[model samples]
Target: MENAKSMEYWLQESALICEFMVFGALAAAIFVAVKFERFWSRGRGKREDYVYDNVLWRPCWRALHPAGLMAYRAIVFLFMAVVLAFDLHNGGIHIYYFYTEWTFTLVIIYFGLATLISAKGCRQLAKNDSIRNQDVRANFLKTDLEQEAHVTESPGKNLDGDSVKLQSHQEREEQKKRAGFWGYAMQIIFQTCAGAVMMTDIVFWFIIVPFLTNEHFRLNPLMGSMHSVNALFLVIDAALNSMSFPWFRGAYFVLWTALYVVFQWILHACGLTWWPYPFLELSTPWAPLWYFGLAIVCLVCYTIFTFLIKAKEKNFPKWFPYAYQRLH
Candidate 1:
């Protein structure tokens, strides 16, 4: 009995130490992400590449159009919404007690926001095309009149036209550099969804489904597809979109998990005895190991997605030169 007591004491102490270590790691990662973002944005006064075109423009391929992208986003958003509604109907509203539901809902929100942006972008594209057509007609008439005059254009007129063109180009550059609030929000949500989706699916398939045998937690068709569909839809969108996947944004992903963990803690404090994931239970001596492993897994999941995006950017252009437009 004395030895058991001693072991219990040491286990509690070690779990405290592990908790501190995990908190420290999260804090350090957030600090690094903030510092990196500041360092990059220092001289530019704005994010250099977080441009409107990244979200607004369609793939440069002749077959792709902004309207088609909008339609795709809308379809995914509606489908996910329907799935979420059905899940709630089948599993009850308490299904949200799981992180899977949270991440799935986030992905749905992302597609909804993406659909709106793409629709707005499509309208803007049409308006710009109309303006371009009108300018082309005006320029053709002006050139024809100049040619008919049989008079040489003055050097001053040529210089003025050149100056106007240069100023217009500069204005467009400024516009591109200035990403508005919605643009930043879209990018943040995209990165967060990428990491969260990957982690949720990984944990569900490899860890939770295989080990959990309880009738309540048994994997069904709806539950099983929920685990996979989130990642599938996200990957398809990522393949089609021009948005960038910066490594620094993985910090947001870490913060996202941190928020979920804190939420679970709150729920447990409020008389909830059950743990959504068994590893999250803190009563055991090995709880620290589980927490540490979880942190590592989260980082690994984010890194895997990051590497995939990097690979896509590097290889897609060479493989599908006509269809894939490189974001970088």
Candidate 2:
């Protein structure tokens, strides 16, 4: 009873730390948004000028364009539902109910708040641009006949007889050149971090846990099945990461899986199991077959996840970042 109490106390403390980390991340995200707004506003001479100034920020407002909002909301809510289901299944309410309820609760709350703020910013920017465009049109309409005749005589003759297209093209080229080295570096870092987290979670769930649990290897059908299911999810997670960021997908998954296997082997040799998964006794040749089958299942799961992500990208381009723009 005392040991159980001690374990409970430790878990409570850990959960508190996790909560702090989540809030810290949210705060940092907000800070980044504010800084970007300030910097862009200063550079563009007006807040509205910075709104449609960059292709990178286009995803935030893509939801407000036609049916995009419905898809965005659906995907986010589905992800939240999955997280909630996992928490409930893992006894989240009972275990951390008293000690860290607010921590887990705040994750969803903060995410929603951030999304709403971004959407509002996009809407305000759009409205401002519309008003500015109207003002420009009115000025053009009031121009004297000679001025209008000169404008129409230009080489670039659109229905509006404005040279706006050439100016827009030139501006795009300038913006591309101005996106310096630091921007590219930060993009790579962010992508790498996301990939690393997904890979770590997979290693922890499948390879580390199963290899460490003795009961998992004893072929107790129920335990074996549960372990299999957990492993399957880890594989799916890896696949999802790869699909979401396709540029380094193959390299990240392959390198991380190799590293995780090597680490597990070293742990096994030392008679130390850092994860909770049960390992099969190596004495039986059939053990290799069973493990191999689990590996195949993982591969299949990855394939399925890749297809799903591709479909999602087609439907909601804003859901994921553009790897090329982000990296360069």
Q: Estimate each model's TM-score.
A: 0.84, 0.36
Per residue, candidate 2 scores C-alpha lDDT tens digits across 202-258 of 443565555653532243443233323333432333222211234323333333333
Which predicted model would earn the best lDDT? 1
Question: Any idea what lDDT model 1 has?
Answer: 0.74
Which pairs of residues have clashing backbones in candidate 1? none
Candidate 1: tens digits of C-alpha lDDT, residues 19-102: 576577679768756665533444232343354554444643447787887898899999999999998998898998899999
lDDT of 2 at 173: 55
- Over 4 Å off, model 2: 1-248, 266-275, 279-284, 309-328
